[model samples]
Target: MAQLGFEVRDLEIFASRTVADGTAAEIVHREHQTSVEVRDRDGLSFFVNTAEPLESDPAADGRLSVNMLWLTPDVPAAITDLSNIGARLLKTADNGHIADFAAKNSGKIMAHFAKTAAHGPLGFGYHGKVEELLERLLAAGIDAHLIDESYGRTLHITNPDFADQPSNPTGPTIWVNEEDQPDQYGYTAPSGTAPQAARLDRDSN
Candidate 1:
């Protein structure tokens, strides 16, 4: 059997106020086992489901209760059953919802190819919205690092010297000179300054 993963796409929110208070309680109780349902809106209707599982807990007041729900993929149902439930049979697409959900929740998604590199094959499957998720992370001020297939690691160079140091010492390495001295020479003064400048000034005079 193929392993199944759930992805949530669009979601709809319903509060007790949307329906008669008594009807709301009845509906909640009747639909406890059902994740997807058709809700009547001013005689029009739409299908709705929780993005995730729902749970109910007793409130501080003994007589009251609170419930939480999430929307996710729905199990395949017969068209007749769905129609009897008053739900319109909207078309279903491939599992992009999983990627969308991951992007929204984690602020990052990984393509299958990229994911395989960072994590071995046994790791979680990659979602296709990695680039969008990365943009979201960057906009939120979170550092988004990408590990390409060629390099299966996120590289961060925190040390100034580390960035300038030669990887193999085959050629000259570049360094930042914050103090106005030649970084290559390790000298305290510029070659054109002090005695050199004085001698040139003397010669010109």
Candidate 2:
């Protein structure tokens, strides 16, 4: 764990899927989730380098560089399902359940937040144009709902109770350095700010 640059025992994970206009939410979540800026303009993706999933992407295989994040072999979806279950439990205030799930699945982990994508094109907050994001989410097969103007964007595909919950006027309690995206469409985020970030930071890399 020391060699990995963190105390493994203290690690916690958070996984998110882009539902509505996640660009802004992605920015905030990046504060707690180690994130990398990635942009999808047309069919081309712009990043620090070529992008591909670690499972089959040779570029992400064992390559250790500031630009390239190394990863483990792909864990079966059954294992990732545990992460999904744990994440939902954590969201619902079930820490004990997450602990139990982690105790079982954290050992053979590779990377990812869980199933990400909008449950549908429901807008949350963040002043950016919601239509564009709505189109993206719809494209991904999520459903559509009302425009969320309350500045509470991030849609946790799990917590149904969180739907009507009021947004916290005070932003996040924890603070972090702000990193810039490389260019107009680039994505930027922390490296290992949180365990969840560590998990989502890679995907085919």
Q: Give the C-alpha lDDT of model 2.
A: 0.24
Candidate 1, residue 44: lDDT: 21
Cα lDDT for residue 7, candidate 1: 21
Per-residue alpha-carbon lDDT of candidate 2 for residues 1-205, written as tens digits (9 for 90 to 100):
1011111111122213321213111222233344323322111111111123335456531211111111212223322333332221111111111111112212212122223311111211222434544565568775543333232223222223334643422122111111111221222112343222123222212
Off by over 4 Å in 2: 1-131, 139-142, 154-205
lDDT per model vs. reference: 0.25, 0.24
- Every model's TM-score: 0.17, 0.17
> Per-candidate RMSD vs. true structure?
27.9, 20.3
Superposition TM-score, candidate 1 onto the true structure: 0.17
lDDT of 1 by residue, 15-111 (tens): 2322322212112223353322333211222233445654645542222111111122322222222223222222222332211112122211112
